[model samples]
Target: MKQVNVFLCLTVTFQMKWLINHGKNSWGIHSMSKNLDIMVKHLTRVEGHGNIVVNMKDGVLEKAQLDIVEAPRYFEAMLKGRSFHEAAIITSRICGICSLGHQMTSLKATEDALGLEISTQTELLRKLLIHGATIQSNILHIYFLVAPDLLGAPSVFPLIPTHKDVILRALRMKRMANDIGDIVSGRAVHPITPVPGGFTQIPSVGELKEIRRQLVEDGIPDMMETVKTLASVAHMIPNFTRETEYISLKHPDEYALYDGDIFSSDTGPAPDSDYLKMTNEFVVTHSTSKHCKHSRSSYMVGALARWNNNYKQLCENALKAADSLGLKPNCNNPYMNTIAQAVEVQHCIENAISIIDTLLDRGLKDEKPNQEPTRYGKGVGSNEVPRGILYHEYEYDRKGNIIAANCIIPTGQNLGNIDDDMKKLVPEIVDRPKEEITLHLEMLVRAYDPCISCSVHFLDVTFVE
Candidate 1:
């Protein structure tokens, strides 16, 4: 075996190609190397419970797979017989990192079933609360979970030694966002402000006035500083890019975070009702996440894809800031996912400010709850999550109980893409020592910035010689 002349794993925004992938929790191997063919009973990288099997027959790479091993939970399948309202709150337990995304998805599904429409003031409040929720989640991902790699630290905990103040600021920012979410969401970790008719409770004028000012004036600026901090570090890597079709929920009026029609570069636009016509899912035996193919091929969704798809809709300041960082439309680099997060933090801040101004000036509009749909109807609810595009499909009863529920989370959507990436990335480093392979894999996960456990968990690798 010939070793590469030089190899360096630099965390600080290493070279990223256009190809961004998601987190995978498992692996499988089928070798035609005439050496060994072992079926992986389970695949994952969590707790280091998996290993890549490489077969070489006279200098030819025959078979390779990095596997994950973790217990799988069927969350969607378990929602049967649950009332729409009950299921809405219960499903929030799916991912600690994906609270607000699931909440709105669940709310929309239930509201559609119930035929309910809320007041304009309520709508504004809903958007504000969700944005606040995203602010918290994004900050957590950018600073607590993601910044360590860009700074070459092992994890957020270790950064305390030298980056204490930065981490503290990030934490406070995250905490403030979560605190706003908690006030509306009931507890922040799993919110319940939304319901079939409207909110379980509404915020007082004093409360709205106070939180709005803080988020726009105080929290937003802090978020910008964090964005600048991350963007300053995004150019270190130049080799992590790969080309893939970017897919997202597109809204013509604004950046599509809360709700919009499903769209892709390949498929122009599909009504929410027609989403099933395009998205297809096949369960992978090796992994819990249902590997998805857009029109039968893997595609991407989430922060980066959303940013790219709706780059034109960005608020002026955010658009200028992203342009300043050299983030163009249709960015294919996975490492730039961090940059997308930075841009969104700014956009969310701007969006929040403008929303407050609109409401404060025009005053809040009032409307009644939607009349319940008597017939069983099906509709899909989709929006950009802090992680990516989240989809919820429901079959409802006349009484507004969820007779059937289906969710295609961002993590599941990225499974096929992640596996494809490993297949391509591993050969580039298979000859390296075991430690080198491990480092590369870790960086791969970090690059995705995935809420993998949003639907599933991380990979567990166990290498077999």
Candidate 2:
């Protein structure tokens, strides 16, 4: 049709213009000074505030850091002396975006410490809740935070005039995901039902069936549309790759988000008990948050890492979406993280639906977790949250009270990797306009979806040469 052709031509023109403008030294930054010192305070469109500082002299890079400027909160210390019953409730305050994840991990750790086993129905509901949170988060990042950069818009608010339909589709998908969490966990944010051992409330069959119907009808179509949109702007993503160790939870049966052993791209697999060693967290002078490394100078986590580790476990629909987006496993490109997230949106939908059907076929039960503490000891719980792998460990006293606690957040694990990424990415784009270079660096950090507020907990910073 003539209208279709006109739209296609206009899109091509826009893409071409954007590429040309961004690829050149339009701002005369390269010529203005032989040395560059750029500081970005309080980055935008992400969950929390952080800074990116880069200093380059005469084309030689120097001093690149992703600074965690947020104030430190002693979350682990807060856990000490708290009752086992309140573990999940208090930990859920870590981040508004990842509240469910914190609650789930905290509960698992507490349950393990108390030597409790959950029911099949409870497990299924937890998985559904995880899927819902993943869907909610990935959709928010892909649509609201990441899309504007690819489409050359200032922000999602500016897109309302021209891209109203796409915005509505995204909002609808996010709402469905939030409702899924609400139905399972009693609230989308800071869920109240999923406590240690098991949930206090469970969804009825009628409610679950309606949720399933909506997922099948509304969720699937919107996801397909989202993939198409990403594919259109895929070219805008920089073709930069820096191979590094990828870490996440892995299982033979399925993509392990809910539970599994620790898996790293460099070092195959380790038991969940070895999480403390696996993290190898250390402090840096440039950051208040701790940085992580394992078998390399830096490593990466989150969706891209999970995809690389468990691509075989992805559902057929999700696999198709990945293939269509040209996203293959063993991908080293961090920019493709947004694409991987889009793929996961499809994967989570399929898995959630299957879980709902299984729950319905088996029937629901109003079971309470009647777990009694037999002994007191240490226990660790790790799961694949949206940002990446999250670990919570607790040492409980004989009286079912916490003595000590430690939580290794995903963004803390990722800080080192982001800094390393900046060191490599800056040189590649240093010849361009300084603003363009800054935008690229910011995009790289945003691709990780770093929750700086969630990460800056407690780290004894030590300055060294």
Candidate 3:
């Protein structure tokens, strides 16, 4: 057996040098040779609990999978028999990080079921809220979660001494993003102002102007620095590629974060109502979260998917940022999902400024929510959340109470894709040292930024004789 070479670098700068010199070659052509069994009990730096399990015997690959260890949360069951007004508020509690996304998607579903038509101002405000949520979530993942891996540290805490400026910059950017959420949606975590139809209270012109000014003076500049920082360490990312189907929401006018029709890389556009066909979710014994497949054995839905489908709609500066970050259109590499998210942070900053300008020009309105139901029936709502395309479906009665509800989380849709990537990835790196192979697997899992807790809401029970 050939002993895999390992480099020990202490500082961020030396780590980059090591990555440039040896990292790429480590992942070069190699044949599987060793018999191994690996299990990561609980992966770190992600939202929820999950384990990576792999077993190999006599050079024959046996099993490679991501075990979703988190227990079911029963969010769907909790939604049954709830009123339309309480739907968004209750579902928003599903994820603290993605609460705004859930709230928006839930409102869209509720509004669709109850026939509530929002005004132009309401739509603009919601879009701004989404932009803020995206900015916040992306920044959190890039800096707090994935940066430690690229920088050769166990966690972000160790990088404080060497990368003080970088840490400070991350904090500043996150704070600004949170401020946008606080001002627009009421609070950063679970938004309070937004409802089924419109906001309980509109933001003042002065508040919008201040946010616009800060984004211009600080947010854009910070994003530019973020790109440079990531570019310096981009070589640390693995150079693995596997072409698969990419799925996301696509709109003709914008980047498709707030609203759009369902789009697939393998196939063309489909109405949002056909999400069930696109996401054929099934039971997987290893996971409480149901796995999804569409057009193939598996597909991906998230930042990279949106980039592949909607790169043309990105702002000019965001396109330039993508080029600088090595995130090209039609990218097959899953590791570049982090880079795609960085590009989105840039776009969200610029787009947020534009949205604020539009809102200020139109002036703020203290209009009450339109709760009148023209017709009560079934409705579906879809939005491109920070992780991926999140769908919510509800059936309501004439009295505005929910009879049934279904939610398809993005992480759940990407589980099968993650497992498939592992099967291909493990063999390529099986010859390397145990530690190195383990790190690669962890990085691959983190690349998708899976929200395991969010995905475990669904569970299938069987009663056998």
Q: Estimated TM-score per prediction?
A: 0.82, 0.89, 0.90
Writing each residue's lDDT as its tens digit, candidate 1 over 159-242 gives 887888788888878877776776655677777666656676765556657767777667767866775776687665334556
lDDT of each: 0.62, 0.78, 0.79
TM-score computed on alpha carbons, candidate 3: 0.90
- Tens digits of lDDT, candidate 2, 319-368: 99999999998999988888989999999999999999999999898998
> Model 1 — which ten-residue stretch has the worst lDDT?
4-13
Q: Candidate 3's residue-wise lDDT over 1-465, tens digit each?
A: 111000000000000000112223333324334467776543422333344556665555565655444335566777778998899999888778788988999999999888899999999999999999899888988998889888888767888899999999999898899889899889989999999889888888888888888899989999999999999999999999998899999999999999999999999899999988999877654444567799998999899999999999999999999998889899999999999999999899999998998888877778999888899998999999988999888889988988888888887787778777876787777787777887787787678876533222111111111
Strongest candidate by lDDT: 3
Q: In model 1, which regions exceed 4 Å deviation? A: 1-66, 362-374, 428-437, 452-465
Taking every candidate in turn, the Cα RMSD to the unseen true structure, in Å, is: 8.8, 10.7, 9.7
Clashing residue pairs in candidate 2 are none
Report clashes for each candidate as comma-separated counts: 48, 0, 0
Worst 10 residues of 3 by lDDT: 7-16
Question: For model 1, what is the alpha-carbon lDDT of residue 364?
Answer: 47
Query: In model 2, which regions exceed 4 Å deviation?
Result: 1-34, 44-49, 452-465
Candidate 3: where is the Cα deviation over 4 Å? 1-33, 44-49, 452-465
